[model samples]
Target: MKKPVISGNTISIPSNQEFLADVDLFIEGVLRGYEIDESVIADIAISVSELVNNAICHGNKSEFEQSVKVCLKWINRKVEIYVSDHGNGFKFESIDSPIADENLMKEVGRGLFIVKSLMDSVDFKITPEGTTVVITKAIQ
Candidate 1:
């Protein structure tokens, strides 16, 4: 598996679950540097992990040649994180509600739901090149 590459506020990794920890570490470290609350940092960390996992498993289909990129930026009192995958984009509307009775018992469909609940805002930018998920959280 290829190792993660970090440059400034961005980190790029091959489409592999093994690199998830590296992403988490880099994110938490940056959040800590900004003096964000531990609880809020945890929330952001969880959201980032969820997005990265989706980017690797679903977006990039776990193709080692593909890469998932994560970029972090602080704007005003909010932190914005962008997770992009080099694959065909997916439809956000197609995701089922994780809390519905039929899906409640399932474990695999909650990543996006959990991310929405934790973050202040979540937006998707889909194009022929790939999909980039942008999640923002207020730090104050």
Candidate 2:
């Protein structure tokens, strides 16, 4: 597994699932530095992990040569995270409802649902280069 490279509020890693722990540690450490509440940190961390996993498994197709980048920023009291992947984008609206009875048993397609449920807002920007998911959470 390739190691994650961290620079300031951004971390880039090869598209592999093993570096997920590195991402979680980096994000939690940044949140703690801002003196964020533990519960809120956990929520943000979980949401981020979901997005990162999707970016790796779905977006980049776990290609070792491709890289996933996570960037964090603070605007006023709100924290914004951007997860970008170098893969062809997918239709955002086309995803089926995970809560539906038919989809309830499926293990996939719930990452974005969980992310939206936990974060204040989530947005996706899909371009030829890649797809970038931005999630925001307000700090109390």
Q: What is each predicted model's overall lDDT from 0 to 1?
A: 0.94, 0.93
lDDT (0-100) at residue 30 of candidate 1? 92
lDDT of 1: 0.94
For each candidate in turn, the TM-score is: 0.97, 0.96
* Predicted candidate 2 versus true structure: per-residue lDDT over 1-140, tens digit per residue: 36799999999989888899999999999989999999999999999999999999999999987899999999999999999998787887899999999999997889888899999999989998999999999998
Candidate that scores best on lDDT? 1
Show the colliding residue pairs in model 1: none
Query: Weakest 10 consecutive residues, lDDT, candidate 1?
Result: 86-95
Candidate 2 lowest-lDDT run of ten: 86-95
Native-to-model Cα distance after best TM-score fit, residue 131 in candidate 2, in Å: 1.0
